[model samples]
Target: MACLSLDLCVGVLLLIGLRCQSCAGSKVYSSPGASVALPCGTRVHGPCSKISWKYKEKFFFFRDLVESGKVIDMKMGRLRVGADCSLHISDVSFMDGGQYMCYDGATSANTTLQLLNNGADEVFAVVGESVTLLCSDSTSPGVGESLRWSWQKKELITANQGGDVTVSANGKKTEFKINPDSSLAIKAVTAAHSGYYECSLFNDSGLISIRRRILLHTLHETTDLPSAPQQDVNFTLTCSLTCAAACDEDINLTWSHSSGEQQQGGAVVKINNTLISQLLVPKSQASQTSTCVVLREGAEIANHKWPVQGGKEVMYSTCSVCYPRFLTS
Candidate 1:
């Protein structure tokens, strides 16, 4: 332990009887009002029975969280250590943003928790798929507080002072539920659910508005399949969505083949409100699966799988006037 430093290391050494080693910086990200588990003890060689943890923030004092496998100061009952020696925290608020250290008798592991800004303003959903719109805030609603979630000025759900939330029927998309963390979950999403969603709070300080404006784009997919691809036979898959002109910046649709090599890719076509992505799949590797995937922000949000099974050998389409297709890009 560094004796000169007045950090949580000193607090743990004085309060608990364990020595902490050098800090290993690891960054973990989570949204506000969400639960997170921080990993620890990757360098330790022995058993992880006597684990202890400490916390510190940039502008705040260090805090001792766990000692001898027990929580010490989380009076709100939100901190616990999992069986894997990782610290779990629920309903995390912005005030809880800090660095956490997990230590054994000799060595230690450190992790820094970064609270996301809840950039969940716009959430895209697939047609017939369930979509969840998060209502994240810097602080969890306190007791005697109430929250009202609205869509385009229409009431969807409300949680009274007692924390019992009541979801009301709003429009055609009726199925909805508020998760324990105050996020609203809607089932079987459609184009009708595309609009602004707002989460409002009613407290002693009057109506405190925590507004979340969201735009949901529902992707519609269709594929021509169940016909196994032979050597030269070809089929195309299409995925389309309707949105504003600028909405395609973060969304992508593509078809993937089982083998590393691709046979052909069709040109993406946009007609007014609809954007379509089609792929010409060739029978390269039979007994494998091909997929049509949708990506947003470089992350796959939806996919449709088509298993390619070769039935029998077939010859390529050959005509004296026909020419081989080529990629332009």
Candidate 2:
């Protein structure tokens, strides 16, 4: 009896598959928090008196115009059916990806919905600094025992999958290393490397589970100071750090003096797609020197130093401007 039941189940599935093949397949692309309508059958088929929509063969909606319209097992209440037998879903999510079937009378149609996330998190890193791009499935954080991770930059030209299979273009893989957490750690970030980075998750059978992207911006800092200075003068020293885009971490700027004077605090920090830090100091009788330190994640990334112009003339032309009067004159 058990064998007979198994055969019957297979027969039913085969029949459903054949019915689905009668209608051409459709594909829809959408992101989370968006709404999409999946057409089950073209208008060639008149209004369906009896319509049903199923997800992977699991009933989701059933409507018999003459009988009744009823929602089935799914807890998500954001699904509805159009008079044309099309299924409309609102506030779609990652879990909503897969095959969907719309049954109208004796004819069945299928639609394959592809869910993509385009609003990737942005990251900014200084040139020559190391950075890690993150990708994860927080909505459905299911990591299979044999789960595999793949990393790609920009295009599919370079792909790394669990160290089992890798594709690179002329040693392009030398710059990036993948971590167990599916994060891509770049050894040294450069302007040439600024682009969209993607991470894909897979199962043991190499089936793609999820795909995400991260926008990385490689930044460079430039500092400007007045060429001429007078002693006991106040001037503004500006450091400009520019990137292709904005990042999550705020760029930290600190000012330090070489005169062994206690480093003063407070710098005006402004951020957008670019970061700017300004430091104001009083020029001393002797040429005082100060440096602007740019830090990210508590590590120094870039610095610029300038000699503050002093009122006193050098006793000798070759004297160091930033040195003390006793040592120079």
Candidate 3:
């Protein structure tokens, strides 16, 4: 996402019948899927009509939420005007986080809504394959602070302020290792190792750690036929996706063959908070590699390639295979 000079406007939101004097500026931090009320930052006194709200999204895109004391259409009723003329936002998302400006016709107030959540990351690996749950830092490390990593709320490792690190001996210790950069590296991950991993750093401001959650999933492939497809037999490679948590956006899965043939599934249904997509590729010709591409909002997020013939599978994340290590069977 590019952050340039703000000249963009989606539409106008108009709110009416609210009076304010002078609201103050504020900063609010919320997680994904929460409700928050952004004060117009105005102090009340006499008649201060014609209040409006504007927001600058994370990508520098500007949105007009209110215009002249009336609420416009945005988020489909998720945004509402409080009795006090504050902007009440429900079902907050990572995409909804940004800077906001409120104007009460005379005085204007500014606010910043910061969303505290993990990057939308999900790793797909075969069972028994070694994988690394990367903890990328966007903030510079401060002195006299520790970086801690946990899985399902259990603290498994810690990197002290002096940079010395230690892994716990809590039975699962042997299965995990802490890398020099503090990223959690698992020796060999089975199906049981699949879950959410959290890395956090605390400062006076709060959890400055940008990456708080990482999804790890072990894939178990099933074949329609008992044995592999031969020259005459047709092989259908099933490409699937399983959401480890609540999917924040619409995820679309597509199967791309080395032959340049691409097929995308329609209407990715969410069942039990998990999403699954499948495709069948017939091994008619000399099949080399079949790639599974995951897209959110029409952009590719992850690309996993496997041999339609026979070899190890590879998964590539954002910025050219962010998964730095590959394991052998």
Candidate 4:
């Protein structure tokens, strides 16, 4: 029993050592203009094992023995390696997108590379308005070849059809023109003009990409009606009211005199209990101009022009009668 227990312990220790060695190296695939890191360790019984990097079956770096330092590939001079075997690639390109591998003799790992176009895709335009679509690549000002922009509308039968759109970027300014493409300018935007728009680039390598659906809306202007009447005197001057939708409640009513004095009157009731409001004036004050304003939830929504006594239903006019002050004789 003692011998069996000792053998079990040894087997467990051996399995742990194997797992640790396997965890020492890792592989990652990334797009061009992106960064990648390598893993390293000093787990082996004989000093730290050297780390090596590769791309597309090419040797990118081999560790230095004397200096114990990292190295980069001459072809990809921009790549950087740290003491810990991590790798970094800045401002990646389509060409740089690919497979990568890391190896430490007995241990090796591999990853596939993928390149992405970091370009703008969608263009938004209002109905009946003109729009321009732009497509570009992740290139610095003076580094890579200029990007060519092209657009296609899904409605077109073929990419080579007439009126196809094309554009080229000078630095950051993209100039647009039409070709067999339909994405350039729709003479006048309409309901039929709303659809999917795709923008792609044409470079040395033929790659086509697209941006998904964008919505266009047509906006219209509307007018609101005048508010209900507030205060009035003798009902000489009348108030007017208007609203976008029909009003429900009885509009509050009041009266005011030409001298700017206000008085409470009977609540103005809607004729036929309809939204329209009307208030009768005392015959004596019929000639005095008065204002009619509507109130809803303590807020004014509409107001008719101040009604004139014996005058046309205009906004403002002169008042005829002035209320006399009572004097004790």
* Candidate 1 lDDT by residue in tens digits, 1-329: 55545574465563453544556556666667656677664567544468888887443346678987778977499988776677878887888777787877677777888776863454455556665666654567657566667765677644554343443434342556676777677666555555556665545433333435455555666556536545676655576765523446676666666563443446667776566887755555445655655566877555545554554322111111111110000
Candidate that beats the other on lDDT, 2 or 4, i.e. the better one? 2
Which 10 consecutive positions of candidate 1 have the poorest summed lDDT?
A: 320-329
lDDT (0 to 1) per candidate: 0.59, 0.52, 0.58, 0.36
Deviating ranges (above 4 Å) for candidate 1: 1-124, 158-174, 204-206, 211-214, 226-233, 242-252, 260-264, 271-273, 283-287, 293-329
Better of 2 and 3 by lDDT: 3
Q: Model 3, which residues run further than 4 Å from truth?
A: 1-128, 136-144, 158-174, 190-194, 202-229, 264-273, 310-329
Superpose all Cα atoms of candidate 3 onto the true structure and report the RMSD in Å to 1 decimal. 12.6
Per-residue alpha-carbon lDDT of candidate 3 for residues 1-329, written as tens digits (9 for 90 to 100): 24234333221221222232333466666668656677666653333247778886544355778776667856678887765676778777888787787776555667888897544456655554677777765553456434567775677744554433344433543467666676777766555565677776644323433345667654433334327436566555555555455555666667666677776533455555445556555545334666666677877666656554432234322232344222222
Model 4 Cα lDDT, one tens digit per residue, 214-259 = 2221111111222433344333333322211233464443444455
Ranking by TM-score: 3, 1, 2, 4
Who wins the lDDT comparison? Answer: 1
Candidate 4, poorest ten consecutive residues by summed lDDT: 320-329
Which ten-residue region of model 3 has the weakest summed lDDT?
9-18
Q: In TM-score terms, which candidate is top?
A: 3
Candidates, ranked, lDDT: 1, 3, 2, 4
Clashes of 3: 17
Positional deviation of residue 129's Cα in model 1 after best superposition, in angstroms: 3.3
Task: Answer with 1 or 2, whichever has the higher TM-score.
Answer: 1
